[model samples]
Target: MKTLMYVFIVALGTLACQQEKKIGYVDNGTVINQYQEKRDVEDKFQAREEAFTKRADSISKAFQLEVQQTQIDARKASQKKAQELMQGLQQKQQMLQQQMQFEQQQLSQAFQTEIDSLIIKVKTFVRNYGKDNGYTYILGTSDAAASVLYGTDENNLTQIILDALNAAYQKQ
Candidate 1:
């Protein structure tokens, strides 16, 4: 028993000296989607989109009514007058189309900017979490790119880091 204890202690010491690095992994999609801030951002954009679509629909209906009225009046007017009315309607349609396109583009850009910012913020949070927790490496995996093929649940930091991140966000 004494000889066995001596060999075990020596083996333990040798293994301690080896200093194996700790590694972990996280599901990027899960972390990003489950984040409160990201959800809020998405909700905000959805509301804005709903409002914009509503307003656009109203404008289109009004435009359609005007077109119908103009068409009715054109039948009783001179040929030259009808031509003038049609030209004006065409120009108005073009302007409305352009304005709607510009507004849509602006909305899309703003949403993308917010999303991009959130992605960077998440990355930084994960990096700091890894460093602070003494993780030698924290691999990220997503549907688009699977950086971690397989990792044990013990080494999975998805919920742990996500909870910390939300707690920090709440503090802010």
Candidate 2:
């Protein structure tokens, strides 16, 4: 029993003495946020939002003008007709607002899906790059600083990975 224990201890020590290799990590979040393509997507979304707001404003102005005209009429039938028009206008506005919200939601989801796909592509690229270059590992540093620190010189592969992604992107 003592001989077996000694053998086990010797084996464990030998394993522990072996060198463990690690690759590098990059702050992916930083790269994505600073990326020109990402900025372009955000700019496009903002432009669309502004256009939708303008359309809503125009509709609102038309509704208000009709309401003012309706209020000036003295006949019961005219007043009733005006009320119906006002109600219809209100319903239209509400529907437009809802449509806008739904579109915004869909756009947000689509952006998220696109960003997710890009992240996956970057990760896969890193993996292949690492394997090809004989790296042991490569990790992503997201927009958050969970795995990375500020002013870190260690494992900062941001530029390397970014270049690889852009190259792949351009090829596609």
Candidate 3:
């Protein structure tokens, strides 16, 4: 009976010596939105989009002028010449439309690729942060769905992690 009592005490002591797990959560939307690197990328993409819009507008205006001139010239042109001009204009319009579509797709693809890569970078940063800070688990919560529905304010690490991430990005 004494040996069993000793064993129980030993077990209790061992359990007491083990540290409790440290856990925290971050707000996913807040982190992504507030992250400086993401903002920078978005700003750069916006500028590119603006530039593309300007060029598209220029192309459209030029095409409109060409159509107006062709219409005026068609009245004085021989029937065959008028037909050729109309066909040429149609072909040019189709080619311009195709080019614009291709450019838009390319821009969209590039933006998606960059955004995907940034998300991966954020995930990696969070993982490394957990490992470095001795976190047993780090949960993510977002407006769409909460991975952590109930955590104390003290356990919310979104701002801390965001600040750290921004600082690291600035150093890069």
Question: Best-fitting candidate, measured by TM-score?
Answer: 3
- Model 1 spans > 4 angstroms off: 1-17
- Give Cα-based local distance difference scores for all models: 0.94, 0.73, 0.95
> Which candidate model has the greater TM-score, 1 or 3?
3
Least accurate 10 contiguous residues by lDDT in model 2? 143-152
**Tell me, what's the RMSD of every candidate?**
5.3, 4.6, 2.3
How would you encode candidate 2's per-residue C-alpha lDDT over 105-132 as one tens digit per residue? 8878877887787667666777888898
Answer with 2 or 3, whichever has the higher lDDT.
3
lDDT per residue (tens digit) for residues 40-147 in model 3: 999999999999999999999999999999988988899999999999999999999999999999999999899999999999999999999999999999989988
Instruction: Name the best candidate (by lDDT).
Output: 3
The pairs that clash in candidate 3 are: none
State residue 70's C-alpha deviation in candidate 3, in Å. Answer: 1.0
Name the 10 consecutive residues with the lowest summed lDDT in model 1. Answer: 161-170
Query: Candidate 1 at 144: error in angstroms?
Result: 2.0
Clashing residue pair totals per candidate (backbone < 3 A): 0, 2, 0
